[model samples]
Target: MTFAATVLTLYPEMFPGPLGVSLAGRALSEGAWSLDTVQIRDFATDRHRTVDDTPAGGGAGMVLKPDILAAAIDHAREKQPAAPVLAMTPRGAPITQARIRELAAGPGVTLLCGRFEGFDERIFAGREVEEVSLADIVLSGGEPAALAILDACIRLLPGVMGAASSGIEESFEEGLLEYPHYTRPPEWEGRTIPEVLRSGDHAKIAAWRKQRSEDDTRLRRPDLWERRGGARAQSASGARHEDRDQGQ
Candidate 1:
């Protein structure tokens, strides 16, 4: 089945921008996935195409009009029924690799790219929308974040990537960061590829990569290492280290 993705945004042209250039683009062209954009402003009921309004009580930035946003979401649903709706917001759950993998395995997604200060709380309350944030920091708008999310999902679709192992060994896939990769010249400016990788013994190479992935994760992303049941993984990695030493 061709995965279907619909994006609702004030700036519809911004879409299929970066997504049209890489693996996402290739998948899109190959019918592995499809994309369509809905202009939120098109749902406005005013001459000026106003989609936002002043804050209810007192706030510096304007809020997206609830009615207008609801209409846009409804329109998106018409085209891609059953697709889960996600609103890009700074005050949402951070987007994670697991979430991307889940979405990639599903039919598709309907993304609502929020702008201005944000949508009226009613938009979320009245609709079954999942709030997703790219990071802890804020952005000028949700479009960029949405693009990133789509790109991530697109790359995970079957056959989109050249190597299946590429997906399996990435950071967060095994509760550890990926080991360093080296290529070409075998020698750089005073640097060279690790000897084990050059040794051509698959077992030893795998063991080296495993230990590096564990150590790097523990050092660079202690937060992830801790969250993903790090102790068990560390123990497993330690066992392997011992086995490698015994074989040596």
Candidate 2:
């Protein structure tokens, strides 16, 4: 099935920006997935197409008008009823690989990009919108976040990647950071591709990768390591004696 991603934003031109190049772009051209954009201003009924107004309680920036956004939501749903609507805002829950996989496995998503201050709280109560954040840091607007999300989803679409198992081996799939990778010159600037990867022994390579993933995660993202029940899980399975470090 072709995945469909619909983004509703003030800046429609920003879309398919990064998503228009590389794997996502290629898949988009090939129809592995589709990108549709809705300009929020188009839903405004006034001459100026004003979609935002001063904050209700008197804040620094304007809040997206509930009625205007509501209209946009209704319009988007009319076109794709079942797809979940996501509002990109810093106040939203963090985006996760698991969530991205779920979206990639489904029909697609309707991303609502917020600007200025953010959506009027009433909009959330009135619409079944799921708010999501790309990261902790703030951006000028949600278009960048939407683009990142679409790119992540698009790359996971079937046939978009050359290797089917590639998706499964990536970081966060097993709650571990991805292992280090090496390629090309085999030796570069005095550094060599890990000898095990070059040993032509698939078993050793797999063991090496698993260990690397465990070690890397423990060293870098101790949060992810522990969250995945790192020590407990590892203990449950018992250490892979074969995974013992070997310069060989």
Candidate 3:
């Protein structure tokens, strides 16, 4: 299982430092995954390593030359033919846990980080690239967004986490938020840990966790609840069908 990522950017040095310190870092060192950075400037034509130019129609910042970026991506694709080329931009689809899971389950991926005024729109129009965004706000560059995505996907790889179920139990796995957690020193500042947690009764703890998760979702993100109505309906229908079969 070779999980690899290629990042296209002028600032290749920005990576590996942050990505090198965590689970992703360990994965790279242990050969479970790989990350390669391609300097877009290396593909420039001029003597000065010029990868950006003035916009065709006049703009505030220089635009990344499409040909240069394209060459960089092509080079990476040649090395890893199975990698998916993704461009980071505020105009792209919103990144979510589901998307991260989808990417992690794939062979590999390539991240294109844009700088200056951003890449020529033609790159997005012509290339087979998926545009992704971290949030509604804009960042100085795509490096941060690319790193954010890399971190999310790498941790989901098998063996990267200590427990396989840790990823599933995390928030958004069940269409509801996760229940609150408590640690040692059951009593703190006049507050006591929930009795269900300390009861040592597994069945009661499980029920309490489920109910708390639902309640947290309702309070924090009611939008997930609205979207989950279809799933809930399907579950009800399945239960009714099973009941009828048992009666027969």
Against the true structure, what is each candidate's TM-score?
0.90, 0.90, 0.89
lDDT of 3 at 20: 94
Worst 10 residues of 1 by lDDT: 224-233
Q: Write the per-residue lDDT of candidate 2 for residues 6-102, one digit (tens) a residue.
A: 8999999997888888898889889898889999999899999999999867869888999999999999999889899999999999999999999
Once superposed on the true structure, which residue ranges of model 1 sit more than 4 Å away at CA? Answer: 230-248
**Model 1: per-residue lDDT, tens digit, 89-150?**
99999998989988998899999998889989988899999999999989999999989999
lDDT of 3: 0.88
User: Model 1 misses residue 111 by how many Å?
Assistant: 0.6
Query: Candidate 3 residues 157-226, lDDT tens each?
Result: 9899899988998788888889999998989998999998999999999999999988888888888877
The candidate with the higher lDDT, 2 or 3, is 2
On TM-score, the stronger of 2 and 3 is 2
The CA root-mean-square deviation of candidate 2, after full C-alpha superposition on the true structure, stands at 6.8
lDDT, each prediction: 0.90, 0.90, 0.88
